[model samples]
Target: MNELSDNEALMMESLARGIAVRAMKDHGAVPPTVLIGNENTVIEYASEALADAAAKDRLAQIARLLATANDATVVTTILESWARIAKVPGGPMTERIEAVMIMTEHRLGSRALLLKIERTEHGKFRRLTPVSVPGLDSVQGRFTGLIPPRSPSPEEIKQARTVLGLLGLSPDGKTIRHDLN
Candidate 1:
């Protein structure tokens, strides 16, 4: 697959932010408190595929502390450790893992407090909003409040059929023939 271009990356970040904000609202989590609790879960799950013995051992220790202690220090250490691990140099998989951790940090680090809107050309407005999702730095403007048309009345349908028939189309719209001599 082709890598995301600048525009695509920006769009992806915007989507992530919107989704994260929605998730936080649904969970009733206040700003800076992510719904995905227990940082240790991240450490354990992220480290599960590691083949390095030292990394596994380190993860085991972090898991043990997370399982037993409510100490703020332990929690902070675990979070920081995961953050560092997320930065470990590797390939695409490693980059993805790091992105997850970065997103987690964003979600748990700030609360969206304001929405700013600006007018653009063509009677369109651009809205800039904050979101909680990782990697999604800014939410983009969207056109909203469009009302769908109601179903057409019988008279309207009949009129449409008449128009189609006049166009040399069958009532069922399956047959058409044109001849010039």
Candidate 2:
């Protein structure tokens, strides 16, 4: 992956915060005061600030977005597009974003993984390791440690299942595996 310039990196952080804030507003969430903080600050702080202020419906919307994604690469690409549109750097995808992607992957397989994203450095994040569910493990463990725990609503799961099926994926035992893989 290409390394982003300092200015470009800051722009990406700002863009992410802007996206989060928009999501909040679109979902009727009363955004947290911290959202108005420095845009170049840590991404985790921005994500948490938006998350804290997000109404249950807003959170559900965000959760559903994460849940329906097919994989981390696709999720990363979606995130990259935002940065690309702003003509900013978007390398070394943030852990918080990765957390949402990985969480969605596991949740689609019916695993309840919970995680919290915390700020570390600017444009960076750290997530709490999710507790493993006994007898329920991902078949494609390609992104084990990167995943955060989160359970999707039944409706979200249904939608995700439809998406996965379209992508040629299906749950086998405790894991969701692609048929062609």
lDDT of each: 0.29, 0.30
Compute each candidate's TM-score over C-alphas: 0.19, 0.20
Give the per-residue lDDT digits (tens) of candidate 2, residues 25-68: 35422122111111232212112233333343343333233333
Error of 1 at 132 (Å): 14
Residue 48 of model 1 has an lDDT of 31
| Model 2 vs. true fold: TM | 0.20
Query: Over the full model, what C-alpha lDDT does candidate 1 score relative to the true structure?
Result: 0.29
Error of 2 at 58 (Å): 19
Give per-model CA RMSD.
26.2, 18.2
Worst 10 residues of 2 by lDDT: 75-84
Which tens-of-lDDT digit does each residue in 108-180 have in candidate 1?
2221222222224753433334212343333221111011122335565465556545545433323358778
